[model samples]
Target: MFKYFFVVFCLSLFIRQGLALWCYECVSTQPGCGTQFNWLFHWTKICPETDDVCVKIIEQRSDETIITRSCLSSLRAIRTDIPADHYEGCRPAAKDVHLANYVNNSIKELDIYRNYYDKTTWCFCFLDNWCNSSPSSNAHVYLIIGTSLISLVYMF
Candidate 1:
């Protein structure tokens, strides 16, 4: 019985340490810093509600813009100071001079809304240490069977 208890304890500890989840609000916040950051496995018990998740940023600018313009090269690093009132021209952080030229020159087909950050368009990730709250990762039914086999080994 002691041995069985030890196994259960170890399993519990392992499950606790197994995976971690992170969420980021890329457009609305600073780089790699925000309330959206979450440990997917643990947060459910603590908050039990909406928790923001991480993202992978992607750029659709022309090849020339990516190479020539420092700002366009790293989409993830764009500062979040874009003005709410401005819509006609480049939004500073979201702007690439080369991209503008590409569109003007007919080299790029312009889809203005596509450039902006939208939840439907943004990339998603299933991070390590994260699982949906419904069926906890600890719900592995085979764990007991594995424990029983290990205990049998000790009996021999």
Candidate 2:
């Protein structure tokens, strides 16, 4: 029983460490992504720094805007630089399929990359502070409260 518990504990710790590393990597990647991509949903109204070809396809789209400004903005501000052939390589949806579906799928995949990194940045800091601080939980609560206030202020 002891051996099994020890093994499980060790595995959990290892997994946590791996997750922490992944979180750090994600945070690091965000800034570049933010600069390169734009939302297909708001493509007509906004010019994302993405490839001109993709922009054209997005703008000419007659159906739903799957890529929102939020997604594009996130990509442009956080992800890596867009590739030269990005647009040329993007496959158009079949006539039978909804355009929105394709856009949504693309945006969703991009979002997975962004979220893995972005949320990690926020959570990692919170966890680090939680672990490093001594004595009462007051400091952790204070940090959380302060960050919440700051976020609220930015939102409004």
Candidate 3:
């Protein structure tokens, strides 16, 4: 009986991993998923096989703070520039994905690559289903709070 139970448990773990990752897909307006986050039950999407991480982008332009929650595919994630341990906070948009693609495929010039951003656009990529539901920050207090929440939501 114990052996049978162990086999079932192993199978369950494999099944869970086989499923695609899900992220909160919403904009700043609509159901109000902006600076004050609102995690509605329907604000989610199962990511494609190429996309395994959830991403949240908060852009502060002029007088508007646009919050966009989406998914980041592995196409650019495999690039050599983005560090493996960059899943911490809001990363710079240009270096992480945008211009990095051009630099890697076309230019291949690392020296001329400057971190550029119009207004304040913070991009955060995480590896958990529905992880982008919250509006996060770089502060240590927010980091601690986020870690605890992740422990409860994903790690458990």
Candidate 4:
């Protein structure tokens, strides 16, 4: 019975991990966008399983800076760097399925920046959760370990 419970618990964890690709979602017109202090009020957005990348964009204009974040299709996420003011792509936490094709078809037309608006600076990032922080993992792991230990203690 304990063994069965353990197997079920582990399987549930794997299932949860497989079912979701969470990302940060926010848009701010403030000057310092996505900085540590600015994220205090923002929340993480649970993205669809089909979306593999979390993208963050920072645009600096003469008057004000804007920050936006969302989950994107792997195709769109790949073209983070275009001839813009500023752009960067971070390594995805999970293996991207479209990476091979993107690398092979490195054409200028395929870039996402072609549609971008003019700006002083732009930046992008691909990460697991919000800004490289996986808030759920630590809690989930602790819960699993705590449950296992309790079960063992009760059994003994």
Best by lDDT: 3
lDDT of 2 by residue, 1-156 (tens): 655555556556546653231111111123322323322211122223232121212212243222212222334444342332332223332232222343536445554332222111110112221221112423434764575556555545
Residue pair clashes in candidate 1: 19-129, 20-129, 23-53, 23-54, 24-53, 24-54
* lDDT per residue as tens, model 3, 7-74: 55655654776577767777787666777665543446777765467766665656777777776663
Worst 10 residues of 3 by lDDT: 74-83
Name model 1 segments beyond 4 Å from true: 1-14, 22-50, 64-121, 126-156
Tens digits of per-residue lDDT for model 1, 65-153: 11111111133344332223222222233343344333444435545334533212123334322222122343443565586678767
Error of 1 at 138 (Å): 20
lDDT of each: 0.35, 0.29, 0.56, 0.50
After TM-score superposition, the amount by which residue 89's alpha carbon in candidate 1 deviates from its true location, in angstroms, is 28
User: Which pairs clash in the backbone of model 4?
Assistant: 86-122
- Between candidates 3 and 4, the TM-score winner: 3
Pick by TM-score: 1 or 4, better one: 4
Quote the lDDT for 54 in model 3: 73
If scored against the real structure, what TM-score would every candidate get?
0.23, 0.17, 0.49, 0.42
lDDT for model 1 comes to 0.35
Count: clashes, candidate 2: 20
Worst lDDT 10-window in candidate 4:
83-92
Alpha-carbon shift of residue 55 in model 2 (angstroms): 4.9
In candidate 3, residue 1 scores what lDDT? Answer: 60
> lDDT tens string, model 4, 31-98?
32344424445556666656355665555546555556666543254544333322235322332244
